[model samples]
Target: MKLRIVHQTVYRYDRPVRNLVQSLRLTPSVFEGQRAHDWVIEVGGGIRGPGFRDGAGDWIEGWTVRGPTEEVTVAVTGRIETRDTAGVLRGHRELIHPLAYGRGTAATRADAALRELAASVTEAADSLDLAHRLSAAVSDAIAYAPGRTEFHTTAAEALAQGEGVCQDHAHALISVARLRGLPARYVSGYLQAAAAGEAHEAAHAWAEIHVDRLGWVGFDPANRCCPDERYVRLGSGLDASDAAPIRGIAAGQGAETLDVAVNVEDVERLQTQSQSQTQS
Candidate 1:
């Protein structure tokens, strides 16, 4: 299937900021499931710095806005060809060892509740089955409630509350996976639409566990399934903040508000084979 995407983020400040700098992980991943045809990231009134691909295979670019300005917008437009890989991350190049993901960051640290959640999983035939069980466990533990948690809410906190959006689900799953002695990480990406007609304000988040013989496999506990062709992976890290598509700071203090819009649509319905693929 061919997909066209447009993602735009606008930041409005109460007062003009002195300067702004941002690191972007907006580019799509290079893997067997997807290929980028045309892609671009544009920042209004900003200068582009040198960019590079990190060891984790994510492209990072720096942008600086010499602002005494009150508003800044980052826009991304792209087209990509994607296929279903059954949530297996194949052909992705990265130097970081899977064991390295076992280390938990502040956002994914397992607390008593998270440990209990991990312990609740029954033994499975294999690690892959265990991974699926873990995913289902998380889905059952947390109800999908948007606006119930903030961006900085930790996995433990979300589990305590028993409700949150995709980020919380990702973090909670990562924490539980780590508690079970499996390597897991958070993934940031774009989904063609919300699952089950639920409303969403931004992109999407999911968890990836390294299963024996399967390498890295993704699971969307929020959606209760593995990522299929509708998902476009951007980057991965120990948790959401670490894999944030955009991270930045303003040189001077200024109250800020953010708005984001993302659209992913199938663009190749004309071809017979493509129509069948899209229908799937």
Candidate 2:
């Protein structure tokens, strides 16, 4: 399947800021599951700086805006061809050891609850089976209820609340996976909604666990499935904040308001529209 995506974020400040700097992990990942085409990232009135691939094999680009300005916009547009590899990340080059992801972050730190949840799934046949069981345990533990959690909500907090969005689900799964001696990380990306008017966030997240033989396998407990062709993997980190597609700071002390819009469409739909226009 082929997908086209547009993601835009606008920032409005109460007072003009001196300057802004951003690190972007907005580029799609290159693995056997997906290939990107015609990808572009633009920051209005900003200068593009050095870009590099990190040890985790994620593309990072820097942008600087010398703003005495009140607003800034970051826009991304792209197309990608994807295939289902059954959630296994294949042919992706990375230097970091899988064990490195075992380290916990503030958002994914395990608590007694998380440890118990991890221990609840103990009858798996192998590491892969255990990973799947852990994900299912997380899904059963946390109900998917949007607006029930906040950006800084930790895994333990979300579990106690028993309701959260995809971010919370990913964090909780990561926490419990680590408790089970499995290496896990958070993944940020886009998911094409299954049907028209479906209530799903185009900007989505999930968790990936490393099995002994299979390097990294993704699991989306909120949706209760593994990632398939409908998903686009951007980057991965210990937690959401670390894997954020956009991370930036303004120099001046002005409160900022943010608005974000994301759209993902099938390339076949786009082609049909183009053909109709040509006929007209």
lDDT of 1 at 234: 98
The residue pairs found clashing in candidate 2 are none
Model 1 CA lDDT for position 11: 94
In TM-score terms, candidate 1 sits at 0.94
| Segments in model 2 whose C-alpha atoms lie over 4 Å from true places | 194-199, 272-280
User: Please, what are the lDDT tens digits per residue for candidate 2 over residues 28-114?
Assistant: 998999999999999999999999999999999999999898999999999999999999999999999999999998999888998
Return the lDDT, model 1, position 206.
99
Please give, for residues 1-280, the per-residue lDDT of candidate 1 as tens digits: 7888899999999989967999999999999999997799999999999899998899999999998999999999999988999999999999999999999899998888999999999868899999999999999999999899999999999999999999999999999999988999999998875667543446999999999998999999999999988899999999999999999998777899999999887676436667788899
